[model samples]
Target chain A: MNELVGLSIGSIRQRLVDCQLSTVELVDAYLSHISSQDRALGSFLHVDADGARAAARALDQRIQSGDDLPRLAGTVVAVKDNITVKGLPATAGSRILAGYDPPYDATVVARLRAAGVIIIGKTNLDEFAMGASTEQSAWHPTKNPRDPERVPGGSSGGSAAAVAAGMCTVALGSDTGGSIRQPAAFCGLVGVRPTYGSVSRYGLIAMASSMDVIGPLARSVADARQVLAAIAGYDPDDATTLPHVNLSARAGQTSLTGRRVGVPKEYVAGITDQEVRDSLSATVDRLGAAGAEVIEVSLPTTALAVPTYYVITPAEASSNLARYDGLRFGQPSDRTHGHGAASARLRGQLFGREPKRRITIGTFTLSAGYADRYYHAAQRVRTLIRQDFARVFDQVDLLLTPVAPTPAFPLGSVADPLAMYQQDIFLAAVSLAGLPAAAIPVPTSGQLPVGAQLIGRSGDDNLLLDVAEGLEQALPVSP
Target chain B: MSDTTPTVEHLTKLANLELPTDEQAALAAEFRRIIDFVDALRSAEVGEAQPTSQVTELENVYRADTVEPSVHARTLVETAPHQQGTYFRAPAVFGGQP
Candidate 1:
């Protein structure tokens, strides 16, 4: 509905460069949109309009004075609250951290700011980026812009909501399981969950340390591409970051000719959701029309994805979230009886119902008696999932699958926890494999924004984005 | 996977929450349903697979443990709901009065 909101980030950058749109003006426009519509949409938990305007004005001055401007000068971005932004609240959507402030910027935030992007404020999320829907947020749930009553799938729902509602041109969100891609699919945006090692994890409030990856969710694939290009690359602060790779935007030379896309039989079989299956099938056809080849391939271990992901993520999350014992950072008094009593109190009060449940399950699974039965078994299954992807990559440039079992379910609709876990079936495999996955919406199907997932080879992050961008253009966004 | 004796104290300790007796039956049923769902991995054959703690190959990258200049301690502590001097304050765990 918003023409400017739908503009690709690269094009917007060019418009600003050509003086057609000033940094300050664009920031103000976005601020006006947020003020007008964000309440209903629940897009942002914190909106720093004045701060972003000040930064945007400074960038405008630099450009006006003919200074060498940063790559994303004055482009406004909405940040997930899990990420630290100096002087802004980094709540992670938990009551324990409702007002917790970080003294410094997250490594990614620092990089985005260095690129001259104006960070408007923090978006809502699942408490500590834990749940699939923003419904888990302590603040408010972000509704899907396409259908306001349905959830904008999360834990990055607010990020997707903000982008879809034209509150921010691009936003950052972390994906552990389907956090980024699910929300992106639900909201009809380009959600990129990059190769695990591609982006740094420094200063992101840890959920599952191994599985968490921060990526861009935006209105268009190109906008997602631009945002990824800016904050991706390596950070010395994060041990897991892969060395930087050079990405060239050979504009208009986008040709998918000879790019082989594999349709994994295991991914498609047994899917009962007609709308989701049809959307993926249609997307495959669209990819072919966009000059790509498609073939049916098998990833037999696909069934193990959710099991492996739940095991490994909970195990890792138990370790990652162990830091929030109400002592050093959060509600400090809860754990302050001294030593062991302190840890007990801190752990109980600071961590909410969901976090405690997960940590409990994880610790039990990893306990000495059960490690062989659960934790080690899950690890072995993870290798099988990766091997399945590896074998498929040998046959095709990309592997296509339905991003989830269904389109966005209604907020609070899932009553069973297992059903909630079932939603991550398509997502968990790529995460376990440590490969790249891009979620591009299928235009037909009334634009429920069902994502047709593409899995790229281990380090080929750019190729997936290119394929997504190409498919996006071939099939215009619907609904 | 075996239900022998209910290690009520031990399991409660692992669960971290102080649960009252009335809620235990409900929580147990819920946990059993979850475990049964995840047990689907048993049928998945992963004989030759490697144990993947992390997906990619990354060794620890460490920098010197020098204390770099950080934001003001007072300002960082200021956001906590309850603060005394430099520390955060929260409710007592269980029934232990402090």
Candidate 2:
């Protein structure tokens, strides 16, 4: 409990401001920790010690100057590899972009740096944020900090593991269908998947453009909020971003009293884990006791989220990933032994199996003759799923459900792809609805951490965080 | 008729991936399994629900064709593995042309 590594991001910033520690000292400590610890955990694709230290020094000077520093001043944060940091290798955890560097920092990265947030380094992820676990990362699989044998959850697996292992104060993760929250669940961290476009997508390599949302994974809900506050808001480059609003409630102001919380009956219907269901039920009861009115609601199309998302996401991904044709970024191989064919061979050898596989699946799904049969049909179903959530929201201010059907399953048990896809069932619907949801670690209730997902109305990001703070206090932190 | 047996090869080509025989077989099986699992959606009844392309009601936004600043060529080519006069060069690929 006295561990600074495991302390909340808010506390870490306070310590720095109180002159108890310097940003450079914090970076040095974490760099030493990463150098010693990251090999076993496989968290970062690259740990930029020199860059981080330089930034830390600059931040230290700012703190010393006693200028108006953002609340997250001197906090260490890790960025998912997909989000570009100028001069850093933006690999998106794929060999296709093994050492690609962007000319400019992603808007969010620039914002964090402006706020005096020290970017520790780039964390590993699914190849193009495509897989269910970091096992699919091009270079290495990020192991669960809790238990190395099990996955940290993905495609933001490394970011979650970084926070869980006390490697960073906060980490930025993108959720396109539970990528952020699921890993947070696995690693016992607070993961918030803000409403789509709440955070700028200007620098993030596109996975599913529509569903991709940037959020924070941290040691506590408050820590997540601090990082979110720094990064959340609009960038003119990303037209989807909402203008930044000062959300007071996100700092744990709003009460649960009279807040209509809905328990979607269909969510827990097929889930076999009695304990997971009981935990969610108990969360609802806890909220009710916290003075919020909890009601039972049904979303019949909830089960269809994964299917619809898989279709729609791959369609967009196919187009987005097409830019990596070996001409602009990454290593370009000889393409004309006889023609442009030889370079294709060289390029083919450079990318790993997963990146190649996803690009192919996306292409095939969006191809002629199959486009309507697959992508269009999925969109129609996505409509029903969206309407289902909208209908529920009309009756309730927030919806409660399990972040996942069960706690972290053993890593290797999900060998079957369909079973792995099924795991995102509870999450894809919220992504489809483009709603803000917070997954706060309810407790280790048992072996692994389980989180009760609080999905709020569109743009209700502040309210979602408020509910998360309430849940954080109501729920026991077994970690 | 598209044969599912070629799904692996097609996907590999489409994704610009070279899969070993073992991985090819694995991907084929996995793709088939997922496609089969979600195939049930095709049979579902949709009364009058129109195909929804995007969930958010926002319009497709665009800037007024304004010229934004771009990086200098030096910075752009800073990370390139090979560079020649005002261009990035690599191992030659063309046999007849080059």
Candidate 3:
């Protein structure tokens, strides 16, 4: 069991093909580990032991029958609760969605199942994927496996923590403004936010639809590459998914001989931690040593990304979440009078502080008088942000920047709402630009992990993955 | 935009939220702070630049106008708090007099 839990997907596949490890044994190992160890971590909201056992037994039979196995065969994958699986309780980490079971599987979930991945459980996350930390989840907060006192950076905190703790091989997390990357950075894992519209968002609970992307959080770059390949492609259900989506990650170029990696000047300015700065410098030096030309490039609109994201996200969220009016789903409060009054009471009762705050901000900004001033202005600046990336990509193949201003801080330390929003300062812009970026942990001198993100042009996801693999090899993380 | 800093009452009314006095006061303060923070976008000169509402280049996607079976109406209403004959039940929109 100990050996089974620690093996990578690549290693597991080789063993499974050789009949050294049965699918049932793999599922039982992960389930037992979760049962004994997950109490303190609070990573999983619901562990589907019965369902996992049934699937594993079926896979074992197929393996015995000499049937060809799928790519993700015999691997355990944990999903963020927001992404629905058929008959699984998907609350999107909100009390407002309590007991709401999705009637069908999300496209990604269906894809994962089709590829022979056993979904172990639904994990915890920020309510509606709103907060930077998973502290906002109505259920218990997910603690960082590294240090239980600190937070596993969130809205995808549970998935990151589960992978970090060896509870699952690889987990799927939705990155809407750094939800996946931030937690991966904090937990010392490789997280990728694919090109917007590259992965189908048909089943992902909407949070800023334009920026929300479903991605993989895995312990190694190779595993992330496999998971991305299995799930990324055009889906008929999602019109936003790109038609010519390419799903390949090859390490054809071992050395970064011709790659020109950009280091954004703005990212280094306000980063006060010398340790974080040094870790980033070491990563760049390694890339340079590997023959990649690392140069300082400027994205002048970097500072405006956070504000623009906050404005645009909430504006869309306000419109998207308007459907939850205590009628079709969730429990409604009894406030006398008519439908209008009851919905008002219901939302007021069920919404968490962050959701209410965003709703208010959204309603205020998109108001008749202020719509042009705030919402339109933010969108126009979003255009400028995208232009900034487009112009910089012309000069360099990719940009290397710090994943966050700092590593995982102690949980409950950030109480102020605006301060919490600042956690994504370094990550939100990539989402705004609809670019592909990968976050890999750099071997830092300190105890906590610090990650550097590689940002590539839209549809250059394969290139970024290859680069991430190169960086991972250049500066291998210590266990 | 009001004379004295914007109150949660106005925003709540717009957002269809009902809050007690204390929570409203707290919400009002937080709202003021968030709005102030977002005001930083005013510095960027976005003159004549087109707004990018959607990042994906695809637009006006059309599918065949054919009917496909979907989740039954009963299945949809099964999760609702109150339902009557496969219909989601909600409080009356009009006032009690109706």
TM-score to true structure, per model = 0.92, 0.93, 0.98
True contacts kept of 2: 0.40
Best by lDDT: 3
Name the best candidate (by TM-score): 3
In lDDT terms, how accurate is model 2? 0.79
**CAPRI verdict on model 3?**
medium
Compute DockQ for each candidate against the true complex. Answer: 0.39, 0.44, 0.71
What is each model's TM-score for chain A? 0.95, 0.95, 0.98
Instruction: Find the number of clashing residue pairs for candidate 2.
Output: 6
* Candidate 1 residue runs with Cα over 4 Å from true position: A1-6, A247-253, A335-350, B5-9, B20-25, B60-98
Residue-wise C-alpha lDDT for candidate 1, range A203-279, written one tens digit per residue = 89998888899999987777777777777777767788887655433334357788899998887885779888788
Per-residue lDDT for A255-315 in model 3, tens only?
6877999998998895888878999999989999999999999999999999999999999
Mind giving the per-residue lDDT tens digits that candidate 2 earns over A1-479?
22566656666678877889887878887887887888899999888888989988887888788876677777888999999998889999888787688889988899888877888899999888987788878788888878887888888999999998888889999999899999988788889998777788998999889889888898887778877787877678888886554544146555788889998888878678866877777787788888999999999887677777777887788778766656567766564553255445654666665555556667777787787778878878888888888898899999988887777766777765567777798898898888899888774447777777889998888888887887788777766
Candidate 2 chain A: worst 10 consecutive residues by lDDT? A335-344
| Best model per DockQ | 3
Higher-DockQ candidate among 1 and 3? 3
Name the lDDT value of residue A277 in candidate 2: 73
Worst 10 residues of 3 chain B by lDDT: B1-10
Off by over 4 Å in 3: B1-6
Name every residue pair that clashes in candidate 3.
Answer: none
